[model samples]
Target: MIRKTDLFSGVIILLGIAFYYWILGSYFPGKKIVLSALIILNGIGLMVHIKYFDSYKKGTYVTFMGYLATLGFVLITTALELLEIFK
Candidate 1:
């Protein structure tokens, strides 16, 4: 059975991915900020989940994946910003 907290975490992760895709592919300033905020919040939620959900291996794996996703977002955004500056 999926706990409410776990379900919330999954929703957050999905939102983060959607935000990353939209921000990285388009030029929407508002969405960029919203997505960035969502990612940070999702990270926090994942950390909390990790601490409380010791029995769930899937939570650990998802948290790790979330960290990677956040890293990828930062790298892609940085590269894009640098490209703009250079041009």
Candidate 2:
């Protein structure tokens, strides 16, 4: 069962991705700030989900894998931004 917070966070993440895609050809400071905030929120949501699983002692492996995947996503996204790959 996904919590409301998690669902909201997922929506934020999707919106952020869309915003980033939309702004790929145009550079704007405010858009960058919004993207960063959304990424951070997604990360926080991932952590919350992991913590919830840990507390319940269920699907620990899956949660750990999810954390790894989330970390990878963040790292890759940051690297691409730093490298200006989208620009």
Question: How many clashes does the backbone of model 2 have?
Answer: 0
- Model 2: CA > 4 A from native: 55-87
Residue-level lDDT of model 1, residues 11-75, one tens digit each, is 66566556556555566556555655654665666576556655454457876565456445544
lDDT of 2 by residue, 38-86 (tens): 5566566657655665543455677557545655564555555444533
Per-model TM-score on C-alpha atoms: 0.50, 0.46
Candidate 2 TM-score, true structure as reference: 0.46
Residue clash pairs of candidate 1? none
Alpha-carbon RMSD of each model: 6.1, 4.5
